[model samples]
Target: MMTSQTTTNGRLSKRVQEIKPSGIRRFFDLASKMENIISLGVGEPDFVTPWNVREASISSLERGFTAYSANAGIIELRREIAAYMDRRFSVQYDPEQEILVTVGASEAIDIGMRAILDEGDEVIIVEPSFVSYAPLVQMAGGVPVAVGTKIEDDFKVSAEQIEAAITPKTKVIMLSFPNNPTGTTMNAAEMHGIAALAERYDLLVFSDEIYAELSYDADHVSFASLAGMKERTILISGFSKAFAMTGWRLGFVLAPPDLLAAMLKIHQYSLMCAPTMAQYGALEALQSGMDDVERMKQSYKQRRNFVVKSFAEIGLECHIPGGAFYAFPSIASTGLSSEQFAEKLLLEERVAVVPGHVFGEGGEGHIRCSYATSMENLEQAVKRINRLLERL
Candidate 1:
């Protein structure tokens, strides 16, 4: 656990030292210090939390309700979450025994990895993916085996690809559809292939559906909803993206009772529970925030179309993103690596984007541009990107 190498400040854990800082934040931070930079680096929504959800939290404070609930979360929130899952994703869980709310989806993923992984256990992560999966697996004493997908396949990792990576040491399959950097979504028929693989290998699955509510071309098929998968699946989602409540820091996990018990042990020891007020806000969100979510989804759809078309016009080959608010456009024609393109674009055009290589295999020679900002910003960023491409 300890490392021989020491910094002037102090010694750090070997595990901590090996993990690189998030690539998404490096450009975002640099852009923050500069003047008039249009950053598409961070994957957060630009929308504010709905007023009703905010007011519910305010009302809870006014009523002097500020104490930790049961480590699993408040019964009301958990019940609402269970109902929401059943209605929205066609999955069901017992609120009292199967759901645990955490600080955010990040915490949910971290604790879920810790709950299931033993030393040397392997997790088959589909990439290019959200940046945290491999590092979190490593942190929890598991190995991360990446299964890269091609843009030609619409960035969907096939069951065959996943099967090829499985071994006797494999324990879990981590998935994120309506994916972070690529914005690709696999339909029910496509996901059934992976579900069959999970069943065949007797492996657990961590289904990250944080972007589930934002699918544009089709309804999101929750992996757990597929036959026989619910028993072995850990479902992670939250109010952050759909409800535009990222600052609220609320997320929930659902699994079978026994598996939830294991994750709850980690939640109780490190983080006692999610924020009290945020839970109240989330409760209100589940109750009456569908309309707000719909409005935001419409806006994102519009922005997604604009970005994709703009990229095509500018000679960047971007696959049409099916969901989420990101556009991954190939920058190979410019003869620059993803990092080079992102850095040069930032410095030359004042438009910041995340280098796709940071998202892992199959991400090089491309860049991830988030369409989560306003259309005006998106247009200006595209124009700047076009200007840079012309110069190149």
Candidate 2:
């Protein structure tokens, strides 16, 4: 079934050719060549990894810890992660059998999809989601069916929307709370509705809660914590956002023993194990980094308030994001597409933001601005954005 049309010079695979590059990276690449650019494009945190966490890694290396861990991960790290889950989100896992350490949440997503999706299987993904979800599904031979959520609904996909998209081929539902690009969060009551549907349909759920600790209003409710839902949910989270450890490239997955075993098989052959020192660093973070996380979260909350208010003053309507550090303000009034707005802003004002359409449906006419940078940068960026609107 390999068609000549799907090949590039009879070389590249069809799937590889069809997948587009990340829109966020494209803008960052364009901005990188220019000087004095204030970029809000990448979702990385501005904070450094806390001194205690960094020191732990350094100490481990000093003591000769530069070796591959067990295929699952170092036992101590897995046990700590299990305890963190119980205390933080009320979900419990058996570290020895039900947890996996991955290169990043990105890798976890990839391996998780590959492990579960047979060719032609369907996964219902919530739209305006992280860029990786659909493409990863395609690469794994699963059809990604996207369900669009509205800003009017605070960008939270409802049970009804997901149910409507499901068919006999549907096998999984993917969710990201404290959603990327939108910075929205759903409460316990709202999550229960989706959980109910999953139970009814007997579908698996992938809940990406990487930004859970960044929530502003209510505590985050893990999808697995709902009654009878733990067995059916794959909970993915990491230290990237909350602990400011993006460079460490470590993330973990919690699932039922059966599902975990399948993903572990993929992980074992491909990655072997995460870096040894990074696992030690993560253990320190879990044991001592809560105060640091709290401080960073509070700073983000202040930045979020300022960004939303500044957008309002400039006449750009935005939802008050409940969590995470992104503010998606509608740019439709400026008479430009989201891509046009982002390009012009970068060219004319030296400020970079991601176009909303890149995040998929229900995302046009808006742009995503990250408040993860310093307050000074945020203020300057706001001024430049205002100038662009005025000129338009």
TM-score of 1: 0.98
Residue range 90-200, candidate 1, lDDT tens digits: 999999999999999999999999999999999999999999999999999999999998888889988999999999999999999889889999989999999999999
Which runs of model 1 end up more than 4 angstroms from their true locations? 1-10
**lDDT of each model, Cα atoms only?**
0.93, 0.93
Off by over 4 Å in 2: 1-8
How does each model score on TM-score?
0.98, 0.97
- Candidate 1 differs from the real structure by a C-alpha RMSD in angstroms, to one decimal, of 2.0
Per-residue lDDT over 355-386 for candidate 2, one digit per residue giving the tens place of the 0 to 100 score: 99999877888999999999999999999999
> How many clashing residue pairs are found in candidate 1?
0
